[model samples]
Target: MEVGVWWTRFRAVLAFSDAVVVLGAAACVPLLGGARDPWPVLLAAAAAWWVALGVGGSRDQRYLGVGQEEYKRLVSVTVHLIGVVALVALLLRTDAPRPYLTTAAPVGAAALLLTRWGWRQWLHARRRHDPTWSHRVLLVGNGATVDHLSRQLASRAHLGYHVVCTWEVTSAHEVDIAETARALVRLARRNEADVIAVTTSDALSSELLRRLGWLLEGTGLQLVVVPGLLAVAGPRVHTRPIAGLHLLCIEEPTFTGATRVAKRVFDVAAAGAALVALSPALLAIALAVRTTSPGPVFYSQTRIGKHGRPFRMVKFRTMSTDADHRRAELLTANELDGPMFKMRDDPRVTPVGRWLRRYSLDELPQLFNVLLGRMSLVGPRPPLPDEVRRYAKDTRRRLLVTPGLTGLWQISGRSNLSWSDGVALDLQYVENWSFTTDLVILWKTARVVVAGTGAY
Candidate 1:
């Protein structure tokens, strides 16, 4: 089947699921002591919520199978649904029960998000086995950009982009604008591609891009221009049309103001709560580390935090007391590249330490670091002073925000991640930091910890 047909069917499934959830929530309102003859209020609320989800671009094809934008739209729509419900009640002079509105909003939103997540999993699973479910992408650009973009897309098959072919235009002088555009169209047709993704290239001028769009008119092929910038999130970018030219406006991420305050507050509150909740486990781990190894239960190491500030980062001792003494001997056997030292089976690691590190239980003591304002619940990994010294200028951006106990680096393959890959993930997180993104990362961290595939 065509990718469009599959997407359309998936969207319909989402709409139907949403309708069922909304109606189901409305039906339960009367039981919750809602308006007596709640039929009118219930039906109106259900109809409005369902329609709002549809028209609000909650299920837009662009965000259907990838990224957090779809979930963001769902959240925005749900928030607006509340305002619309209240406004309607005021205008109609109906005594819409507060309980019903409150109940419906949260319940409906949760159910909708849950269903969407489940459906996304299903779509990803299907796409992995059968490429027909994904968008066949034709990449056009300079060789370097094409290579980078292709690798990224191919690595994440869940994103639903399958690269079919590439047209590498080395320079603007080598290719005529009209000829390039026509060649892209013919190439896309030959490959049966659904999308033409033109990566950043001087060979593709604005006029040529515009001409390509003109030529693609009524051709049912999607045109996407990939910017040169890397690791940028949708929230940080805005596009506007002025004087018939599209201008891309990129927003710089700010680490100050109310958002920073909110983040600090969240880190403190969450870290405190986590410590309280996991107190019993923490004690057990400390006891295990002390009894299993002839060393102190905790290890403290100087790590670079925000702005290159050094702090003693604490963790449950996951190595023998002589681990540091033996480090010089194993330095040559380091499994990971760059400044970080990681050995899958180092002789200095105690048996208990190995278990703790496997599931990252050793990092639990970092909750104290988070409380102490020396680290964050989520951000880039706290770098070693040696690692910081070796960092390139671009890599120093990790210090712009407080270091994290667990971050994209931790959740994304942890020790298994190549140093460059880990650095890229950290940079991406630094640029796209958000409360919602943090919540998502924390949730994923739980799953990753349990799997323990990437941990040493």
Candidate 2:
């Protein structure tokens, strides 16, 4: 089904669900110490809520998925509606029951938000199995940019964009703007495209884009302009209209503030609690490692941390005692790219070590690092000193914050990632660090660990 039709149906379903919640809350009023004759006020409040939702664009197609903006708008609209209701009650001198109003507003809002979240999860699940659920995207730009954007969209399937066709132009100046716009319209119709995404090109002028937007009017085709900036999140990017020009402003990454302090506090509390809670498991792993290998139960390695500081990162020993001594001989057989050394099946790993590595039980000891302020619960993976020495100027930015026990790299493929891909994920995390993003990464990490994929 087309995304537009699916969205329309989804919006209708949401409206019906919201109305049910409002009525359900109204029904609870008398049971929760309120007047039985609450139907009139409850119906009026429901009508006001419906109008507020529409005015706030809570059901807008653009803000439907994967972000907190839709929920924020929903809460905002509900609060405003409640305020208006209270104002009207006051103005009319109607003795509104406080218990009913308080209970109904919160309960109804919670129900509406929960239903929206459930629907979003359903949509995401459908998108994974059915390509038809995605918005059909028509890409237009130079070959390089088109390929780049296509790969990005392909990597994040949950974003609901499926590139149906790509129109590659050597230079936008090669074609007339009006002719190009006409060609796009024809192509979009032919491909049943819901969106036309154009990547940044020097040949395309603002005036040309303006004319193209005009031509696309009434065609129901949404035009999206992709900026050249890579690895930047929405919170750091803003559009400013200066005079007649729409300038895209990029904000610098913030490494200090109350948020950072809160992150540290959370890391300490979570790490400390986890250590205490999992102490029995930790002891069992230690005993197993000690009995299975000649080496010590715990291994500590010097890893580079925030601002070029070095710290001892502890982990369960997963290799024979002579593993480090044998490193030089195995360097030639390294399977990984860049400065890192990795092999799917290394002879140095003991029998128990292999199992520990496979499930990442080896890294559990890093909670101490997090507790001691040497690392965070979530951030870029700590790099070896040798890895840091070989880093490019841009890759060094990952050191701006504390290293992590597990990070984007860990959840996103772990040992399976190539050096470039690993570095990119780390840099992306560093540049777009947020508490919400951390929570998302941690949730995904739990799932990934359970699946035991890409771990050596």
Clashes of each: 0, 0
**Candidate closest to the true structure, highest TM-score:** 1
Per-prediction TM-score, please?
A: 0.93, 0.91
Residue 328, model 1: Cα distance from true site in angstroms: 0.5
lDDT of each: 0.88, 0.86
**Tens digits of per-residue lDDT for model 2, 1-456:** 764786787778777877787778777777787766746866775676776787898888888866888899989987877777788778898866465558877887898898888888888888777768788999988888899889888878877898999988786559688888888878988999989988878877676678879988998889998888878999999989999777889999989999999999999999999999999999999999988768799999999999999999999999988888898899998988888899888999999999988888999999988988999999988889998999999999989999997899999889988999999999999999999999989888898888889998
TM-score of 1: 0.93
Residue pair clashes in candidate 2: none
Tell me how far the alpha carbon of residue 199 in candidate 2 is from the true structure, in angstroms, after superposition.
0.7
Off by over 4 Å in 1: 36-48, 96-100, 240-244
Poorest lDDT segment (10 consecutive residues) of candidate 1: 29-38
**What's the CA error at residue 225 for candidate 1, in Å?**
0.5
Residue 221 error, candidate 1, Å: 1.3
